[model samples]
Target: MYLVMRKCDDGFRWLETDLGLDNLDLFVADGVLVGHLAWWSAPQRANVSTGDGAISCETSEIFPSRGICREKTKRGVAPSSPDCAMANLPHGGVLKDLYLRDAHKKDALAEEALRLPAVVLTERQLCDLELILNGGFSPLEGFLNQKDYESVVQSIHLSNGLIWSIPINLDVSSEQIVALGIKTGARIALRDPRDDIPLSILTVEDVYRPNKAKEAELVFGANDPAHPAVSYLHNQTKEFYVGGNVEAIRSPSHYDYVSNRYTPTELRSHFKKLDWTRVVAFQTRNPMHRAHRELTVRAARARKAHLLIHPVVGMTKPGDIDHYTRVRVYQALMPKYPNGMAELSLLPLAMRMGGPREAIWHALIRKNHGVTHFIIGRDHAGPGKNSQGKDFYGPYEAQELVEKYKDEIGVEIVPFQMVTYCPDSDEYMPIDEVPKGTTTLDISGTELRRRLRLGLPIPAWFSYPEVVAVLRQAYPPRLQQGFTVFITGLHASGKNSVAHALQVSLNQQGTRPVSLLLGETIRSELSSELGFSKRERDINVQRIAFVAGELTKAGAAVVASMVAPYEEAREQARSTVEKFGGFYLVHVATPLEECEKHDREGIYKRARAGKISGFTGIDDPYEVPKRPNLVVDWSKQSVSQIVHEVVLMLEQDGYLGSS
Candidate 1:
């Protein structure tokens, strides 16, 4: 007989009056049965007792939270409650979408049975009770025939579907069990099957229990952000943690970061309520300096819009200053902003350094956050270099690409030229405005850093001394020592060979240089999982650029050979590296026919046979170097001859010295 134990609060009164078995010495062999039964729906109490009828037993009990259970009588005579009302206990609702069997109801019920005051079984003890119970014997017969009381307790705790059961030997301390329940976030309760009484229930508390959808419904109402539910659900994905023992919450997107608990719909409503006719978004990884501030202030004033200074507060490339510090710097400058025109919010976005693609993603994200205009600077998502030590994309490419997607993305792309001071004009002017004839008083961030490190004064016209001091404090001089030599050309255009030759030559000349060969190095250094798609290739190039920047910081000259066919990718690389060390473009001008002839690897030959698509020269368009610092024609020169020319170019550019 499968005797199921159910706990209810109503069983205590019935057992005390109808059965008259409350005070009987209820002993079965060496074990005794004890019950602290109470009614399920009504408040009627019964005390622990040993009944004396056909068996003899002794009972001992203790209650710390409430001292000793008391027998209480109501309405003069004993309360005659219906058994059906008392015994018909409702099961907890079925849990849906059970990812694991361990989360099933049967398992929950088995765990619940162990905490009963009358039983008190450990997980091991519960298993033994199942064996005895399945043998089809009465409680007294089972006890007499059972191997040991401890074994019985262990059996019951392990039994499937057994919600509660009486245990022979209650060895586990209530404190220990309660502590376990608390730690595991599981519910604990004491229950009696015969009396249908439940006592001292404990339940697990939900951590991420906030009603996000409901909150969103209340806040957003009808005005929901685009792909609202999908966006929130995507944010709910988690990462494996604690040796895959548990999952941890992922950082939310930029939209979710500012809105906090409010749903996307509610956030939209909140945005609509604001008297913001025009919303301009400024995207930045660094704190605003004078030039940056000036640019944004002017842009905001021009459009008569409110400036939303949304700074990225997510993972960035290595060696970048922490986001917290950048945010603090912005806070210090907040007071200087015109009243009621500027707003600041942290945007949580993982930087792809994707140059063009990144620019598009940034604009779309700002649009989702209710911004109408987005600032797109040169080289927006620009990652430095590929594992093979090659630049993936150009700086200006990001801006141009974003412009292409502007109408589709539904956000205005604000283009701005590089801001610099013109000494002849005695005023700050965009780089484009500076006359070619006038001596350009251009100072790079790298040069400024070097000057500050050497205790030299930075010209006040170029930047505020306070800003220079802050930059110095943030980045010391030693970290600003490297430069990148970016090589661009078609595949098999002697780009990689020339880069390698340059490395060998630089080393022979007593210079320790790092060389990044785009294709070869990427296959070896980065994870094999990363493929060679246009996007991946772009990412690889950015990573290479980042590494080159680091090497430059270490005072090492970096030689990188990459098929940077696009002008935009090169521009971005130049902008990024020139910010710290310096950038020089070396165009290896090998004609399509000559490049195909030297395609010893048969890459070009395969393209001719239609075996490959997007072949740099044959199939895809290869943008020729419009203006490069040094251009080498492989058709007109030998490998050694080209190497000598490279050395000459480096010496002329101040990368090397004349002997």
Candidate 2:
């Protein structure tokens, strides 16, 4: 006999089950059942008795936060909850379509919007608003108020007891709060940042400064900057959260993929029209390939359900492929699918990459779109790695969490496994199902990107020609692509000289156009008004990075050399430039004493004499990069040698080829 523990409102109760030990370990590990009476044998408020290797809870015991065990049938299988069986129902038993469809109401709301203080939505906020207005984030009428926000962060549930894992909040800067006089009961117009079009009017319910550290730790599982979402939470998000009810005047306009943009109601209606009662949704932010196709097809066939290709078109992890390219790839794959068995739609979701929490959130969103099952793959919605280069979540953590909450989410979890191509059979099969010693083949994402950069041929077995064509157009050979070489050092550390030398060397190649952005040149032209404070220096570096990013995106080589002392500012520059193309950080590690000795401009002399206050390497600090692509002590090495080393580094990284 095994002991079954289930969480109740007061605390917990235990029931006996006749399941064998063989099934208990795997079942408990899957988070479906809890056993091993030794762990819970201790008495709490009331006496706990143990007999026949069974532990019983008499009074109240708090359930473990990892998971709550479900009651099992006689056969030891957890029965699907009644609410989960009602697959057609939306969260909260209602599809809250908040868009104002009536012409008169829309006109009146639009007119009133012109009079209220307007808050232009950022791209991420706009994505959140679109989902909220369309019921894709149903049971949520608007941005979550402080109560619901705290509720979600603390318990992964709303104050109303709905299982909403992620918080939907309108984060605004403190300046906005002061500028707009935002406060409780104040109605503000939510305008689109693109065209200043009023999309909704929100009635402010709460304006509060969120505990961002707590939210980052609880919702995202950590406050480490290595996780993209955690980094964004602390770096990009605003200081205050404005939560309220939003009455939509219209939906955000999407000119691209007009036919593929489906609101939750519209998609559900389309599925009904197609007589698709059991639809399984596949969520992706990347381009789908052969292995993906095989996995989705196998999952759909196994479940006997129709397929929906739902891809996120909003903010994903930084440095991800642009949505335009990914969407094109998805559109190209439509013809590859069996015509009536599958359909495609776009979800404008600002993904937080919250891994396990995000997996449950994705499932709920799909459920709102009438999906009966969601295909959750390993590390679903995971932000790639942490600062230590370790995965933030276990590979199967998302699958396990989603399985634990699948009943309440009302969407069946389809756990995805790695599928490998078997050359012997000329077919793809799950890795576990392939016979031992069978020869198998696969192309990793890293290898695929390497092939794309080097202009090497991608095997036909890995991806279709049409899809490859799209990817190739977007990611051209390194010879045709752009790159940025960011050089940073002390004030007189020869960074500018090295940058100029590198520019000349690259220009001599005649492979790409080269632009030089020297620190003094940028200071004279772009940031003359900024001072030498830490904040001002960061702003100046960001300005240089922005220009470099634009030039790189336009297919030009950018050499930005600056006395960017702070490690954070340098990293910010790298992040900015890398979004477009290659970013090589070259640290001129010329010693401060050597730089002071050279003292070309006498700036170091002034710093020593206190003529220049807050000067780097004097009063302020120069935080050296822990891991730069290349390092050069220019006091010892000549500019030509440094430039050659930089070029060689670039060539080795596939950003450039031998010339």
Tens-place lDDT per residue, model 2, 132-241, is: 88878877778999999999999999886779999999999989998998999999999999999999999999999999899989998888999888888888889999
- Which segments of model 1 are wrong by more than 4 Å? 1-274, 386-390, 476-659
C-alpha lDDT of candidate 2 relative to the true structure:
0.81
Q: 1-659, model 1: which lDDT tens digit per residue? A: 01111232322112222222323211111011212122233433333221212111112222212222221321121122111111001111110111111122334444454553333333222322222222111111112112222232333211222211232221233354444433234444433333433322323222122233432332222113232221332243221100001111111122333433222122233444555647787988875666677678877887888888877665455456676557656776666688887877765455535455557656755654556778888767555554455555566777886666554555778886577666666765677777777665667767764675554677767655555566666554432345678888888788888888888887776644565556567557863565656666666667777777777767787888888767766776776676667577889998888988887889888889999988777777778767698898888888789889877776664566532
TM-score of each: 0.35, 0.82
Check candidate 2 and list the clashing pairs. Answer: none
Ten residues in sequence with the least summed lDDT for candidate 1:
240-249
Count of clashes in candidate 1: 61
